[model samples]
Target: MILKCVAIDDEPLALELLSKFISQTAFLKLEGRFSNAIEALSFLNQNEVQLIFMDIQMPDLSGMELARILDGKKNNDKTRIIFCTAYNQFAIEGYKVEALDYLLKPYSYEDFLAAATKAYQYFDRIHNTPVAKSAEPTATQEFIFLKVEYQLVKVMLKDITHVEAYKDYVKVHLKSKANPLLSLTSMKNMEELLPSEKFMRVHRSFIVALDHIDSVAKNVIQIGDHQIAVGENYKEQFLEFLSKWMS
Candidate 1:
């Protein structure tokens, strides 16, 4: 599948490099290039692209800010983001916006190709033909794939105990693993993808599996050893959920 893509970066060299990479990739078609997020936003308003390769730091509007805006839009799901930055600290923040992948600056062609391949696979899976789509999981889909360290890993929904948002990534707490599976994705993305009947976002940074919640006290949810506090914004809904089973 040929993915229509755009590039946004404040640095002229970065934009040039990204453009070169897109040109070399057979499956990617460069639709636009912007030196600022403001212009990029204007372009996005009028056009639709499957993927975006954007730099994090920019004048007036940063990539992170732009990502949040895009994520909140009506057609937000139509576009996927791949963040390119020089700073490693923003990795966790990138996932918060549900970025498809993170590309550190001075990356090689191979690195760019790997990320593009992921975008292609993602678009193909979601926009498959009728027969193919029919064969895929329905609303009761039991699992999802997450990009971890540049590779996609299949995670069983039932195995997840909770998901905690880190700085730029999310830690998928699982019952079977001693340590959480760290993936480059946002909690919002996880929340939307998960079955609402089974998962609930108790905090801005936390999503807990309903079945895995052992107890709730003082507006805090206990799952295994984790004590997750329900955010003020989410407390009302969570209490309503609890009322259904309370004596």
Candidate 2:
């Protein structure tokens, strides 16, 4: 399916480059391009854009500001957003807006592809499902909210990198954090919480997020900067996941 897309940026070259990229891309269908948020807002009011390539800074309005306005509106399920910016300061704001991905300035086609592919997959996950789950899904379903020392935390199956079995307690590693925040839990209890589609108990010591993986080589799996070892018994399942997804 073609993604109905829009680009909102004041810079002419930025707009040109995005349009140029979208023209070459097979899946993205550009519905509109606006120089500023005013024009983009008007377009958004009337049209249904499934994917947005947005800039954070502009003359009269900012992308973050625009996203805030969009956040208040009701929209269809398949819509996705990717923030385009040179500044790293806006990353937190982008996350607050629930952007699918953030693109640093002068992004290459490969970077664009990575972001776009994620958006497409997200759209598929949302629309292809028989029943749509809430963005902030229920607490009672499967995930646990655990207290580590004094702080209580909510752990989602999708964000988990791995759960390390250490004697009686297991360490939970989740996504979107600068460092992994470990909580006291058990492998047996946590395993039951994970969605079968997104996670795999690859080893007795490790359970991995299948989508967050960066690469797999021989006997190890790379999730972003960290490397997790694949046990002897789990090598086959690990290899199959890598083989199916890796180009």
Candidate 3:
């Protein structure tokens, strides 16, 4: 069945781009396009939109703000989201909002297809489950808040690439930011705190953001310019992950 989809962004060109993409894919049916989040919200209340392609920046209401407004409701509508943004700074928060994936501005048709594929799989997974969602544990998995503890730290939840283990300490690689921050903690503990579906512990020293992965070489996984090794034990699971996108 074709999935009902909608696009929301203030830029006319951006909406045009999404429209073109929807036309290319037979399974995606464009239901509506909104220039702002408020209009999109009102339309959602009355329409059956199964997927949303949203922009992070808009007049009055931003996409991040819009995600907050949609959270924790029993829509049971199985609507998936794919955020379209220009800035890499929003990548982390994009995950926080549990976006299926994001399309960076200037992205190619292949890129949009990739993110859409992920979104489709996500919606399918949730629909087949007919399951209940357990509440998240509080006081667990707190983020590395930025700029509060003096100048010594400033990496927010939305700026991290991965956390590497160094004995009892773990090193966090910041997104598009110079230098990684060192934290005294076990990688195992961190894996528990982070949403397992989003962050994968492919190595004792590496817990990477699945969406940030650029390429996976024989022994290394590339997140932009950084090259991370694939531990022997975790190699199978990593390969299995790549299999999902093989098509």
Please, what is the whole-model Cα lDDT of each candidate in the order they appear?
0.86, 0.75, 0.73
Residue-pair clash count for candidate 1: 5
Give the C-alpha lDDT of model 3.
Answer: 0.73
lDDT (C-alpha) at residue 179 in model 2: 56
lDDT per residue as tens, model 1, 1-247: 5789999999999999999989877678999999999999999999999999999999999999999999999877789999999998999999999999999998877567667766765776566535446676543455666668855577788999999999978999999999999977667667766768889998999999999999989998999999999999999899999999695
Candidate 3 — which pairs collide?
92-158
| TM-score, one value per model | 0.54, 0.57, 0.54
- Superposed on all Cα atoms, the candidates' RMSDs to the truth, in angstroms, are 9.6, 15.3, 15.8
> lDDT per residue, candidate 3, 1-247, as tens digits?
5689999989999989987886666567899888999999899888877789989999899998888777655673477678998888999988887777788898766566556645554555455553454564322222332211222243444567888887756778878768777655557655754556667888867999887888887868899788899889998888888798575
TM-score, candidate 2, is 0.57
Model 2 C-alpha lDDT versus the unseen true structure: 0.75
Candidate 1 local Cα displacement, residue 41, angstroms: 0.4
Ranking by lDDT: 1, 2, 3
